[model samples]
Target: MSLTRLLPILGWARRYDRDDLRPDLAAGLTIGAMLVPQGMAYALLAGLPPEVGLYASIVPVLVYALFGTSRQLAVGPVAIVSLLTASALSPLFEQGSAGYISAAALLALMVGAVHLVLGFGRLGFVVNFLSHSVLVGFTAAAAIIIGFSQVKHLFGITTERKDHFYETVEEVVRQIDGTNGTTLVLGVASIALLVLMKKFVPRVPGALVLVIASILAVELFDLTDRGVKTVGEIPSSLPAFGLPDFDTGTMGSLIGTAFVITLVGFMESIAVAKVYARRHRYDVDANQELIGLGASNVASGLFGGYPVTGGFSRTAVNDTAGARTPLASIVTAILILLTVLFLTPLFSSLPNAALGAIIIVAVINLIDIGEMRHIAHVKRSDLIGLSVAFVATLVLGIELGILVAVVASMLVVFARMSKPHSAVLGQIPGTTSYRNVERFPEASVTDGVRVVRIDAALSFVNAQHVKKLLLGEADAISGGDVTALVVDCSGINDIDATGVEALSEILVELDERQVDIHLCDVKGPVRDVLRRSGLWDRLDGRIHATAAMAVDAVTHPGTLPESLRSLGIDERHDERPADTVDTEVSHA
Candidate 1:
């Protein structure tokens, strides 16, 4: 492994030129503007002091810039991870207490450790198990919950937060009559202003605009005296480095939460990195990205911050702001550091409702309704998986919802694979090409040859189904047992011992019925397995390279030419009379 691979900053820094710095500076300032309001809002969302979010936005951005792979990715606190942080720690400690803050920092450390280990171990591919359907469902549900969880802040009313989504919403609604008039107005107006500005003047940072405007309004008009809650005091100093709690009792309690945070945070970061990398035509190393994110989280935790990830919204802002490199992130970190040092007092008047509005607007984008509808239109099973994830997250907590989503996705996959698609293939008329007989009605089938195509990898999970489907097709024939059964293994990418056993049983059954079972288009690995299992010997010269040759050899015996036969094509025409094909079956 090269040093550049481990420290991605070295790769770009060696080629850094004056031309890149200007854009990086401009983009950095813009991202820093967005991050200030968002960081504080996300910290509140995580049930922590607002400055912790600022603390997170600073060190993580710098760490990721030094070690991360994607040039354009902006790493910091993200909504989903913040919600997860709150969810994970709320039950274990009192919200915003010293114990809660320590737990959050510890969670970040554990999450960082998990990422570092996975990256160093080169186990990045493990994330592939988190199917898109599961993510889609889980994100949409989490977004809704996060949005509703802020409703109390939006209305300026106190309500007990419930674990269940509907219960939380119900409690919020039950307190509707207690809504503070000034807070509601501020929240609603901030949301409207954000929407309008994004529509009409998108180049401007709307959250910054809202935050600044809200702060000015509150301070100028004495809104705090009007029953409007402000953010109060924020420590006007850069984060101080500190070690996280490492006590076995404290750390053990947070291990499970940390694991979930690791998965969610890395998933979010790598996804953003890949998206921007594709646009810039550069490839991102997932494992390297894991190490980068792990380092960022560790840095954040050590510097009095919670777990953070690459946020999609801020990264988009960075890209649109014309950022050319990760230098933009470094500059952004500096600007955030400045904000903590000098600008903290100005934001003391920033209303909680306004920050709540910012969070609401940001998280609203996470709900991918269009994706749900598309999934529903395409695959019912995927839609079910998506639905299961959404509902589970809404009813159960984040951890259980994710658990349900993963299980539901796996179950859906296994259900489809358990009875894998098998088709009866026939040669397209006047062509060497063969297709599903039912799909291509014009195709022709040989009288004595039954060509069955198994459309999935043959594993223990589906071996029995394939065997039964093949036997059932043979039995369905009206005439005496087919003289030859040609099993097309074109789509069978792999075969295990159970699959070989299933084939052995099929061969015996066909032989008892006076049918010669021949295999065609058997993939190399599968053939190797069959040979090792001794099924190849039982095949007795019945395995052909192609379905056409197998059929030709079965129907016309020696008429298949050597070259065409070697390529799995039947050189000879079908000489059997049409009426002799009493059972020319073809179905998808």
Candidate 2:
């Protein structure tokens, strides 16, 4: 593909037409309705005011719609991100305080930088480290954290500590005797009402209903007399744009936390983009997505808001609501802006407990217990990676959790291919192609030639392992039992700089050992890369027309060997998505 042709923005938007506007309008209205409650709930989850939530959904959504590649990805504050914001900022300042909000804005700036860098570099693949199992585990753990942290509000008890799950439970138990009956009653009622509405009202934005009911219940009962806290009077105005107070000391204090926020935000945003791309049957540009997401956060930071991204639930809602262009997101932003201008004070009586309840219910859905089971059954190592990430994230912190998952993923990949499968090959009795000799007992081998397959991409991570495997194979064939060698190159799909350098070293060793090396079945792309690698011209052997032809030539130089001259081999190879299918030569 040409570099100029690879621009995703041009590919999709250039073809967009007036026909796409209705779908965009429908999606905008649906997402706008959903965003109002969800945004406020997420803001509360992030330890911000409900109004700030409304602010985050507005301009950021508009920014992402303009710059993003996804047609339906909805940019806004989300549950997980808000929880992450709270975790990152709670220690630095009092929740809901001015300093905390400023920190949140600074965090958004950092997240924006991360996204911009990754997107430009096309490094979206970084999210692959957080596998499905790890994600499930982390989400489950976060749900528990969100639930437990809100217990104080549930009991109408004021406390100033952050032990996350266990400490919250301990604090609740210690204060159990002091729990206000009125507050507990309110909390319980809110939870139940929200659950019932969500279960039955499906498309009615259950959160909006629950919030209204909670407010009405609190006001009707004059719950403040019994010590229940409300959201208080929110400023009914659009967000004001400003920069975070950036003292060097402040930056020093918060840079580490900001990096964690950046990483988590990137992971989340890219994941949403990937999901939409797959669903819509269009390729998303990772680099451009980075820009879109970065721009959103940058915009959020400027507007007294925290870091934002392509929210999973909102994006799904946008897609299901029939968003056909990025315009839907922009319109959703307009809706939020209007809410900020008119409806902020309606939330003055919304109980913190209700917001917490919404967060807890939402986060609980993220944890996937069945996925852990599947990983444990199919791949214990991967399950371990997920488990380690979960424990680290819970016990250590958010930053450590993400770093551990990345390290674990890389380690798993390296360990598996370290001693990559190198095998002796021969022709099966009733087949014409080569197969691993160990797997096929009835196989034939050319008198002095052995074929081996290396099954993994070549890179610095496994280059040394390949070197060891090649040396061992050379020694194994050293009884002068093998003189000619053909490598089945079907499994080797990619090669890197380190791999080419390693191949050069390996070739030198093979030449010294007097084992002439040849390659066959190198796919077109892989072959082109290798040709550029300069390994082909320097090798002491040939690229075969076919593995079968190479085998026959090894057995018979002038005339076909008696064993092969009569029995013809299928030299024409067909490609399939399944793992390699090879016919072994008869050793019998």
Candidate 3:
């Protein structure tokens, strides 16, 4: 491989021209405008102060831009991952407290370490289990939880605890007398303005506008006396390098949370990176993405921020704005740095209700009801999976939601394998190849010859199903007496030790029943597997080169079964079919 291929920025930067500068500049600025408010809102969602979000955006973007593969993917804090970060750390430390912030920093370090390890091992294919449908369901479920979880903050209620969403909701309703009208009005106004901006003037950076307008409303109208809570003061200047305490007990507690963060955050990053790559007609190396993302996370942890990843929404805006290369992300980082230095004071007066509104509006894109409808229509079991994940996230938690989603995905996969495709075979009227007997009316058995097509690869998982189907077909045709069985081996991709054992058992049973087995058209790779395992050594029947060869073999005495010869089954037909039974294993 070329050195430039490994370092994509080298190739892209080599061709960088003044001609591409305009679009990249515009895209970077537009995305930067959007990122400012988004960064702050995501920080709040992650249960940190707004500045941590800005801290996450600055160095991570520059690091990923230099080392990452994608051209337009924007690296930052994302919605579901941010919520997951909050959930994972909440049990370990109090939200917005010093210990909580330290734990959050530690989590970022752990996430970075996991990514670097995976990238070094080139084990990026692990994210393949995060199916697109699962992501759709997970995002929609997260969106609902995020929107509802902020309800207490939006409505402005005082309570002893803000733990269970259902309980908090009950408290909010029961304590209606304690409701703060000013905060409610502020939330309602922000939501309405953000919604209107999203629907009508979406390119205007509605979050920024809402932030400014909400602060003005609070300050000009003196809403504090009416019970509107502000974020109060924020620290100015850049974050200094520091480390979270790494006590042995803390490490033990963090192991599970870190694992979840690694999986969930990495999967999110891969999915978004792949999308951006596809939209831009580029390719992605998931392993390289891990390195780039890992570097970003390490930067985040060192700079006093939480875990960050390739954000889908921000990347979309970046792509749509015509970002040609990762240069746009670099520019975005500079913008964030400028904001941290000069813009911190402006957000001090910004009401928390507006930030909550900004988060709610941004996550609305993740609520995809249509995907659920399509799943229900095309695959009802997947619909059940989606619903289960949705309910689990809302009533239970994100970790439970993913646990249920993975279980559902596994069940669906196993269910399909349990009923591996099988079909009866018969020759077409005018061609030599066999076809599905059920689909083609012309296909039918000639004399006592039988052809059985099994779709799945021969493995212990579905070997019994194939065995039962073959024996049942033999019983149907011969009433417990049969002369021969032909397996169209083009469909049998590979066989394992257990499958070979099962096949041996079947061969013995067929031998006792006076039935002979014939194999035809096995793939080269499968043939190699069989030869290496010495399966062909104790063979029970002749392996024919093709279906026609198998049929013709029975005509000759040397190839004919002992039962067929004794029974005086001598005649064979020359007729054939053009297309044979086609079968193959699906991708895992």
Among the numbered candidates, top lDDT falls to: 1
Q: Give the per-residue lDDT of model 1 (tens digit) for 162-195.
A: 7788888889889999999999998899999999
Q: Which stretches of candidate 3 lie over 4 Å from their true place?
A: 1-7, 159-165, 479-482, 555-588
Q: Could you list the CA RMSD of all candidates, in the order they appear?
A: 5.7, 7.1, 6.7
**Count: clashes, candidate 3:** 5
What count of clashes does model 2 give? 15
Error of 3 at 368 (Å): 0.9
Clash pairs, model 3 backbone? 431-576, 431-577, 432-576, 432-577, 433-577
Which ranges in model 1 have alpha carbons more than 4 Å from their true place? 478-482, 558-588
lDDT winner, 2 or 3: 3
On TM-score, the leading prediction is: 1
Candidate 2 local Cα displacement, residue 323, angstroms: 2.8
C-alpha lDDT of all candidate models, in order: 0.86, 0.73, 0.77
Candidate 1 vs candidate 2, TM-score winner: 1
Give stretches of model 2 more than 4 Å off: 1-26, 121-133, 163-169, 374-380, 429-431, 437-449, 458-464, 467-485, 493-545, 558-588
Encode model 3's per-residue lDDT on 362-397: one tens digit a residue: 788789778678877887767766776677766777
